[model samples]
Target chain A: MKTLWSGSREGSLLRYRAMAFTVGTGLLLLVFVGIPIQIWGHSKAVVAVVGPIHGYLYLIYLAAAFDLARRERFPISRLFVMISAGLVPFVAFIIEHRIVASLRAEERSDATAS
Target chain B: MNRESDRQVRWVAPRALVAHLLVLCFVPGCLIAGWWQATVAMSGNGLSYLYAFEWPVFAIFSVVLWWNFLHDDPDEVGGRRLRELRRDESISGERAELRSPDFRTEDEDDELRAYNDYLAQLAQRDRAKGWRSR
Candidate 1:
């Protein structure tokens, strides 16, 4: 039977990393790029109008990170850190880098074991 | 894995694919269309117009993308088997085991044979009862 654990470890890890990167980058764009421009360049009206959308996107990013973590069996603490990184400016980039490094390490170990 | 066993195995359908596609198309479409309407009303302020419109769209798109991430494989067969096993264990107090090389295939064949036998016995009884009535 095809179980959840049946996929190639490297492939699954890569998928999770990609998802993390996608979400992290999206959040970065909202906080760094979207929010500042709305508050400074535009008006409070602009921020007000766009606020709901940002909230929704952040929620989605968290959900995606959670799903990937579960599928890959990543430690819950690490997953929480990764999810929280989106809340701070430029933290997503750092989290993304960490994810890539850990994933590479995982791949190397899996390769050695096989 | 053995090719024979792999062939017998079926992959459960990913339930999220359709919902993901719908969100992808609908969210972007709504954002773009909304921006177009706003621009038409405002009569083109250039940088402000693009900034005002695109950010919200991107934000909504990102949220939809994230929402798609929350998924768990629906326990299609697992739940059914758990229920059946629970019932069997309660009644028999011995773990039910099928005596077949391939349990699924063998069980299906056994069920069909039993059904056919039952139908044949019913037909025979009907014929015997008819003769008695006559």
Candidate 2:
């Protein structure tokens, strides 16, 4: 069976970091920036125009997050949290910060032990 | 262990990358085309079709990518090498020790023990087969 984080640990960690950043940023931009701008500045026509794009991007974000979670062997409970973060407005950023901090701590402890 | 050669290792095939890129390119292209159609021709149905198609296609694409990611090679290059070295040394030493004169009597004793074990195994298998046949 293939091992989780099959790439170099550093590479895997960096990928996870990037995944968290992009997914978090993408969700934030959609919920905070894109949705609000569409609601305030333009017609419902504008929401019609941009909503699908945001949805597609959000799907991509979730996929990236799931990939990172699987590679990291994240616990089932934490994985649920990570997955749910994208669905809620502004939660992605918060979860991103928390996950990154936890991952960094894990890496530090692993390094110290080895 | 060639470091340069190791650097060249890639889990993803070139064809798969191209396929993924095409899907990525097509999703945006379809979205853009749908938007233009909506603006110029006022085709709401066309826009709806684009929106409907986008999610399912993207969902499948994401699943495929994650499957590939999960099946990527293990990262045990150095550890595997060390394991092989240790295994070889242990096997060779065992062989050398087994060749000594004192080991001859032990080997005969082991062979007698193995004969008894084999008889026991055969009897167990026969009993299992008999039960199955019944």
Candidate 3:
């Protein structure tokens, strides 16, 4: 029952969540559908569309990850991992899941404390 | 400060100067490549058409990043202010003139301090949990 805005005191977390979802979906389509079609069917059409879309989404994902990292004061290595998550298939989903859970747990504890 | 002196000292600090020099070198290259792609696209190369527009966009983004870096204040850059604010978070500005107040009320300050402490404890716990899971 946690909201996007609930625990994100710095306001970057929600934006990161949205970007993660988009990057995750884009990568999934490109990897699962587009690459398969390009390899087996001898057609470049699916890759032609999904590849550029994923690239653009990945750019936005990088920006979002940078924003979140700055707000969280994350180390550069952690930020690099977050930014790279969008490029690999299904990694964004896992990272996003961890991020959301931690944020929610922090928020729940803060609510009880206050 | 005189305009030329200001430019030398601040606008083109050694780091910014290097960055600006790089930008100057690359923007024209990108534009030239974009132009070549445009010509190729005009001659009916489909993939070159997409890149024809893309290279120019890259040049523009580089220019924007350079401009932001040139004007950015060292202390106030990015989220530093936000981090400071969180550290000294208060509900009211009643003690604004005091800069750093020695005696803080127990209510709002306590909440923030407790939250920070909680976060520290959680981080330690999480590190332990990560090790355990591995």
Top TM-score hit: 3
Minimum summed lDDT over a 10-residue window in model 2 chain A is located at: A1-10
RMSD of 1: 19.3
Model 1: CA > 4 A from native: A1-26, A33-42, B1-134
Give lDDT tens digits, candidate 1, residues A1-114: 233234565445554555556656665666667778877878555454444455556555665565556555554356657767777766766776776665554455446446
Ten contiguous residues with the weakest lDDT in model 1 chain B? B91-100
Clashing pairs in 3: none
Docking class of 3: incorrect
lDDT of 2 by residue, B1-134 (tens): 35434544453677456646756775676567655545654554544655665555554654564444334344543343344344444444554466445432444576767875675565445434311122
Off by over 4 Å in 2: A1-6, A32-42, B1-43, B57-134
Candidate 1: true interface contacts recovered: 0.00
Quote the lDDT for B104 in model 2. Answer: 28
Enumerate residue pairs that collide in model 1. Answer: A57-B63, A60-B66, A60-B67
Superposed Cα RMSD, model 2: 15.7
Candidates in descending lDDT order: 3, 2, 1
In Å, residue B49's CA in model 3 sits off its true spot by: 4.4
**Model 3, B1-134: lDDT tens per residue?**
25433443375468777877979998999999999989999998776777787778768866865664565445444354344333233312323335235333355576777875675565445444421122
Q: lDDT per residue, candidate 1, B12-95, as tens digits?
A: 334345545656776777677657756764886443554456546554644544342333222533453344344433323321
Q: Cα deviation of B51 in candidate 1 (Å)?
A: 22
Can you tell me which runs of candidate 3 are displaced by over 4 Å? A1-11, A112-114, B1-45, B48-134
